[model samples]
Target: MIRLGYPVVGVADLTVAAAFWTAALDLAESPEWARDSWRTLVRQTDGERVLGLMLSDSAPEQYPRIHLDLLVDTTAEQETEVERLIGLGAQRVDWDSYPPDPDFVVLADPDGNVFCVVDLSRAPSGS
Candidate 1:
């Protein structure tokens, strides 16, 4: 049997990405897993590894095929989290593909990696 590990994001600058992600998600840098070109971020509450960052020279995709979706219970919480993430250096994406009434907001990290903040309460009727 196999188990999935944490998501690994490619970033242009390891230091900057590490700082933003750790603060934005309330994670802490895992010093034991630190490397010259890699960072491991773990949950502060339980020390469970959640995300990894890898130094890469390639640019982020404008429309990434795979992306993270941060969840919130309510639309109000989603709105607040979006603002908070922007305050932490995330930029709102001018996504042209949004539905007429989208339950998710698109954003890009400092490194331009795209992700979504989804409101569970506003999810599609069947979803």
Candidate 2:
């Protein structure tokens, strides 16, 4: 059976992206594969990698079809996490696609990669 691997994010400045992501996710750099243009971020709990950052000059998609969702159990947690991410250089995205009573907040990383902070507790049934 095939298993899902880490999501690889394209970034303009690998060093800055690496620093921001590591702090945001509480992950650590994988020293074994660390480089100027690429870095792997590992989860601190089990030392398993969560994602890979690759250097790229291309601009981030204005409306990416694929984006990461950081899940939190409650709306309070989601709000707190959003604030923390903003403090870590992430910017809140003024998204226009939200439904009524939305349970997620859109945000962008330092490189303008879009993602969401989702509150699972507020999700509709069977979602």
TM for every model, in the order presented, reads 0.95, 0.93
Q: lDDT per residue, candidate 2, 1-127, as tens digits?
A: 9999889999999888988999998999888588888899999999998999999999999889888999999998998999999999999998989999999999999999999999999988883
lDDT of 1 by residue, 3-83 (tens): 999999999999989989998899999986799999999999999999999999999999999999999999989989999
The 10-residue segment of model 2 with minimum total lDDT is 29-38
lDDT of each: 0.94, 0.92
Q: Give the TM-score of candidate 2.
A: 0.93
Clashing pairs for model 1 are: none
